[model samples]
Target: MTGPRGRVFRTVSELGIHYRRSPACGVGSRSPRKGPRAGDRLPDLPRGLQARSSGPGWHLLVSGPPELWPDERIALVLRGRDDLVGVHRLGGESPWPDVVQGLVRSDGCLGFVARGADLEGLRAYLERWLPAQHG
Candidate 1:
């Protein structure tokens, strides 16, 4: 498949290569265990969440308790960002074990993962990857 930049990708996995970052880049570490990681296709979300995950642009999935979710400040920072499709709150039964937050690419690949309430990490990842929308 050819991407918007006219780069030819031989497979669906290759489609997200542009979004992948090395561990040194501070996105997420590639682990030997089986689980979500940067560049890995996002695992199946719950039926309800899957329906909402569809659309253009990136999607933010926040799990864990409400207190751990991104606060108003983060929300304000993300406001008006055209690259962001929407934010969906995942329930405790989410497939991604021990993950508190995840950034899902438009092509259904996991671009970033946060295991803790690392709002700063999320902010940084977005800043480095997605372009900010200017008025």
Candidate 2:
């Protein structure tokens, strides 16, 4: 419904289809955009997975299957959850994010990301990755 960033944003999950622009509309290339051209970001660099009603309820990108493990490093955007345990708030309306810097990696070991609104759920997940003390 809005074009605020280079990344045209929309939520698609079967139960019919919703898009940022009309299904027939097209997003122009960066050449039409402003500023020095360093090229657009690699598509799906900040990937996400969500629960849907129909279509592909669970979508995975070309990042190869994500680690999908607890406390794993990620670039995420959650919307809050009452049933989730360790989820947290990370991203927001800013297309080029400025909130959480933890998503960036110096080593590139980071793979995929998740989006949810369950802060407590994420906390519980991080706890699982904690090291154990053997006797």
| TM-score for each candidate, following the candidate numbering | 0.68, 0.19
Show where candidate 1 strays beyond 4 Å: 1-34
lDDT of 2 by residue, 1-135 (tens): 345432334223221222323222222221112211112121232333121111221111111222332233432322222122223232342222322111111111111222322234333323342222323
Question: How far is 69's C-alpha from truth in model 2 (Å)?
Answer: 22
Candidate 1 total steric clashes: 0
lDDT of each: 0.63, 0.24
Query: What lDDT is obtained when candidate 1 is compared to the true structure?
Result: 0.63
Weakest lDDT window of 10 consecutive positions for candidate 1: 24-33
Tens-digit per-residue lDDT, 54-106, candidate 1: 57888888776776665575576586684565787785756566646777778
For model 2, the superposed segments whose C-alpha errors exceed 4 Å read 1-107, 131-135
* Model 2 superposed RMSD (Cα): 15.7
TM-score of 2: 0.19
